[model samples]
Target: MLTKELIANIYKKVPKQNVLSKIEERYVYAFDASDLHEKVQIPDAVVFVESVEQVQEIVKLANKFKTPIICRGAGTNTVGACVSVHGGIVLNFSKMNKILEINPVNMTARVQPGVVVGDLQKQVEKIGLYYPPDPSNLKVSTIGGSVAQNSAGARGFKYGTTRDYVIDMLVVMADGSVIRTGANTIKNAAGYNLGSLFIGSEGTLGIVVEVTVKLITKPEASEVLLAYFDSVEEAVNSVNQIIKHQICPTTIDLMDNNAIKTIEEYKNCGLLCDKQAALIIEVDGFKTVIEAQMKLICDILNKNNAQNIKYAKQKEEADEIWDARHSSMAACAQLRPNVTTDDVIVPRENLSILIKGIQKICSKYDLIMCMVGHVGDGSVHPQIPIDMNDKDEYTRYKLAKSEIYDLTARLGGIISGEHGIGLVKKPFLPKVIDNGAIDYMRQIKKIFDPNNILNPYKIF
Candidate 1:
């Protein structure tokens, strides 16, 4: 409980209007996109700051009170990154949303922590620049959250994830001191690349108040195609052939029959649900080379016995195909009251085995799973829809989840690719990461946050 004097002190640091201390107000920040059934702690207070100085002031206050300070953006992460587990002060960055600067010559965009990813992309693309790190829910996910999780989407196969784009960040350290991780220039041979350490730290290290990300020129042209296969092996063979021919498509996304049927049932998109698997490939480059890329990709797919091929001839058609692919999660969510998605990645050669293994595990558990992934990068997202209220079913779901991670380890893969090891995956981190690495991580955490007040009890 916060004392009256402590509350008054906090009000002195932040405007009275921005401090949320009521039970109802605190309830709003209790959880994020994580499962509602998980144990959640309602924060003592929620504060919104509009400037870096205000953030520092709040951090100082938290230090004095010895309370945890969890930074929040849009709170859309699937791993409970923004959840206030120990419940102290939830620092809301929504009021700090702003694009500080955009430099065309340097191809860099400086932005606040709360800026939406899609909005920044649109702003940059308006000037013929592109920011490629899209974490599926770009419409609502914040740049700060993306950087914290190193988020990436289907485009990650060609352009890397958020970690590759972030050149610098103005981070508020645990002691309320501010530090810039890197410089504005793209190439920094300077001291240690500290920015890499905090990108996926999940707020355990420091709070990112502002970010400067690198951008590239927008592609001149792009096309999308949906290739259907009679079997998963055939789809994997087609992907291998495309890569063998030296065709570097932006994304080679895979959707199993479950995902296709779910999306078709929900959106009525013209998808071949009868097929065992479908590959959504997008090639983008110069205006003149699109046709050749399409032809080469089609040839590869046909050679692998693709049952049917549908290539988009117009921007509208491309959007329709992508919209259907993006709608897979929402469509699966309609199948049950609660849905959980896992990010597991294996080598491209083991992609077929991982997919088949996950499907079999889900079937053994009697759970409904829809599989979709950026197959080109060897990452897969197995989205399972289930009712958490059913005790027996939930028990089986947990077992299936563990087995899937075990299979990923056996296939020489980690439990997470872009998604972070938040509270949900903390138990299985040791299965993928080495013990010495984890020991060093804990030591580093103590060095950065001795009091363990900044998003404590996470990642480790």
Candidate 2:
């Protein structure tokens, strides 16, 4: 419980207007994007800090009161990472949003935690540079949330995730002391790479206030292609054949028949509903090589028995295809009152098996599943739409989830590839990771946050 004195101290540390103590205002911070069936615990207070000094003062108050400090950025994470499970102080980073610096010379950018991922991408692209970590909701997802979850989108097949770009961060520890995780330079070899520890730590160890990320030159040309397959096997084989031919496309995304139908119904993007599966392939390179790359990928698709193919001829067309793909979750939600999405990855070779198994599991539970994935990286997202208020349906969903995780572990994959192990996946962490590794993680958490006040009871 937050005592009156502690609440008064929080109001003193920041502008009174920045602090929210009323139930109605604090209620909004209680949950994140995760569709939790359980009753959520609301935060006692929500505070917005605009500067590092203000964050330090809030941390000090948290330490003094032994309260949990949950860091929230857009609250777009699919997992329950930002949920105020302990009903403590929620740190809202919206006011801290800013792009601090863009160094074209150094190929890096310094940004506040609340900087939206897509906004930064646009700012850098204006100067012929690129930031590759493109989460699906980049337009609204903050850099801090991406760092916390190491978010990666379709481009992850060629570029990489947030973990690859994040080089340094200014983090406030549990005791209110500020520490720079790493030097601002691209490469650091002097000491431990503490920045990495916090990349996917999910706010359990420290609060990240600022981040410096490396950037790369933007591709001169790119095109999107949609290939329809009569069977899932054909689509998966086409992905393997593309790799066998030594062709590196920017993205190789898959949408099963269910995803195709749902997205078409929701957006009317002209997706073929009869196709059993479709591959959304994008190739990026110098203007001279774009045509050659597309031709090679198309040849492989034909050889793998692709039924039909469509290519995006211009930027507008490309955006239309991508917009349809990104709206998949919203489309699925139209089927039921509540929708839940899961991230599970396996070796590329076993990608087909994992997808098939998930389909079977959901079928056994009589659940509606719209599946999509980055086949190049073997990451699959099974989005299931269901009525969470239905007790019987929710029970079956829980069982199906457990079995899906079991199948993933057996196929040599962890439960999550981009999403972090927030509260929703915390119980199954042991199914994929050994107990010894989890113990070490806990020990490390204790070292940084002995009070367990930093997003307490998370990731273990």
Candidate 3:
């Protein structure tokens, strides 16, 4: 419970006009992107902090009062990471969004955590530098949330995830102390490597105030290859074959037939829906290199029984191809009253097996499961359109999800691929993670936050 003095201290420390206690206002901050959880409640007041110093002051008061502090960005998280489970204080950082510095010489950009991903992407692209982590929600998702969740994208196959480019960060530690975690240099062997830790900590350890990420020069050209398969297994086979050929595309994403149908239905685009599965492969580099990669990709795809292949040559076609890919969540979400998206990473060799297993699980649950994901990385998503009003539907969904996770574990896979193990996936974590690893994380949590005041009821 928040005492009157504690709230007063918070009001003094934060922007007085920005603090909100109205029920309707509180309702807006209640839940995040997850639909599995009940309606979120418990934040005593939502305080919008404008600067790093404001974050520090808010953290200090929250620590002193033993109140929960949830660092909220754009609130686009799929897991309950942004949910205030305990009625403490919601540290709203949406006002702190500022692209602080763009160093063209170093090819790095320093940004406040609250900067929206797309806004930064546009800003960086104007200067010929590229920030490639393009989560579907990039238009609205904050970079802080992306870093907190270790967000990935179709480009991850070539460039790797967000952490790979994050060279430095400034974090507000548990005790309200601001510490620079990393250096702008390429290599550093400093103690503990807290920079990497803070990347996917999910707001459990510290609040990220500033982020410095490496940027690469924009590719000279990009090509999108759309290949259709007679069977989903054939599609998976094509992915494995593509990787085996050592021809790494910038992105090789797989979309199931059902998912394609949803996208086509929603967008009214003339997308190929006459296949069991499809591989949307994108390659980028110099014109000659892109053309060569395209030839090799098409040859390998055809060798793997690709029924139909269409290559996009113009900017409109490129955008059309990506538009179908990015609109997946909204298309899938409209299938039912709710949708539970889980990321399960498996060995590339077992991608076909996992797809088959997912089919079985979906059939068993009498649910429609369209499996799609970053096939190049073996990180797939099996989205279940859940009906919130029906308890029995979820009961079966729980079993279906459990079986899928178990199968993934058996195949040397993790419970989460790109998405973090936030509130929704915590229950199934033990199915994939070793007991010792979880124990170690719990111990680390204890050491960093003995009071458990930082984003409680989350990844633990």
For model 2, how does the per-residue alpha-carbon lDDT over 109-172 read when each residue is reduced to its tens digit?
9999999999999999999999998888899999999999999999999999999999889999
lDDT of each: 0.91, 0.93, 0.85
Assess every candidate by TM-score. Answer: 0.98, 0.99, 0.97
Candidate 1 residues 189-209, lDDT tens each? 999999999999999999999
> Weakest 10 consecutive residues, lDDT, candidate 3?
34-43
Output the number of the lDDT-best candidate. 2
Which ten contiguous residues of candidate 2 have the minimum total lDDT?
A: 31-40
What is the Cα root-mean-square deviation between model 3 and the actual structure? Answer: 1.4
Q: After superposition, how far is residue 347 of candidate 2 from its true place, in Å?
A: 0.7
Cα error, residue 112 of model 1, in Å, equals 0.3
lDDT of residue 212 for candidate 3: 94
Query: 186, model 2: CA deviation in Å?
Result: 1.7
Please list the residue runs of candidate 3 whose C-alpha ends up more than 4 Å from where it truly belongs after superposition: none
Query: Number of clashes in every candidate structure?
Result: 0, 0, 1
